[model samples]
Target: ADGARGLLAMRQAGARTIAQDEETCVVFGMPREAIELGAAEKVLPIEAIGIEALRMAGEPKEGIGSRGAA
Candidate 1:
């Protein structure tokens, strides 16, 4: 699948990566493949995904809060 392939390619290009755990995945095929291929650095459950991704994305490059009128 494209997700698995992309993960592999990204790893080959020196990028850290994460994948959803098989137990938490609706479609385990992709994540499973990525894990099997040694592309994923860690596999986390869906519930923890948001926080983990946010942490990785880092302290928001842009300023906090909305840009709309106060």
Candidate 2:
């Protein structure tokens, strides 16, 4: 799978990777391959991926600004 290969390469190059869990993926092929290849640092539901990525990047969950702040 090209996607799996890319994810593997990224992981090997010191980039953190996330794979969509089978439960949430409409088609699990790519993510499954990445998971089996040990390329995914974190396997999560689709809804949680972006939040987790932001957390991993040390960015605030509130996003770039305080627009949502009251």
Candidate 3:
């Protein structure tokens, strides 16, 4: 429950969360736990993860599109 509690605290503090997509994860342990615990708000690929996080962090952006899409 430690990780859950920490995530809960962050949520209470109005913080958003992003987890690297399972496809990009080496060990889908903590992130999987967090996702199952209702912690992560967004799960994105490694390349998109940073942009997603920045977007949630209130960064102004031109736009966001799935980079993997062609």
Candidate 4:
């Protein structure tokens, strides 16, 4: 559960977080714990997880979408 604890601590430190939803979880215990501890800002299905993670990482720092410099 160290990973979960670390994620919780990160969220407590004002970081954005996401967890897999119970329905999509193969093992719901870890995410359930994180949610109970207020670590996760949102829980989404696996299918949409990639999109959510990308959103959390924010728009690319320097890539195709990097301002009009491209």
Best by lDDT, which number? 2
Q: Tell me the number of clashing residue pairs for each predicted model.
A: 0, 0, 0, 0
Q: What ranges in model 2 sit over 4 Å off? A: 59-70
The Cα local distance difference test for each model comes to: 0.81, 0.87, 0.72, 0.80
TM value for model 2: 0.79
lDDT of 1 by residue, 1-70 (tens): 7888899999777666789998889889888999999898779999988888788677443344338776
| lDDT of candidate model 4 versus the reference | 0.80
The residue-level lDDT of candidate 1 at 9 comes to 96
Can you give the TM-score per candidate against the true fold? Answer: 0.70, 0.79, 0.69, 0.72
lDDT per residue (tens digit) for residues 1-70 in model 2: 8889899999887777899999999999989999999999899999999999988787532333338547
- The per-residue C-alpha lDDT of model 3 at residue 44 equals 80
lDDT for position 55 in model 4: 85
Comparing 2 with 3 on lDDT, the higher-scoring candidate is: 2
Lowest-lDDT window of 10 residues in candidate 1?
57-66
Order the numbered candidates by lDDT, best leading: 2, 1, 4, 3
CA lDDT, candidate 3, residue 60: 30
RMSD of each: 7.5, 7.8, 9.9, 5.6
Better of 1 and 2 by TM-score: 2
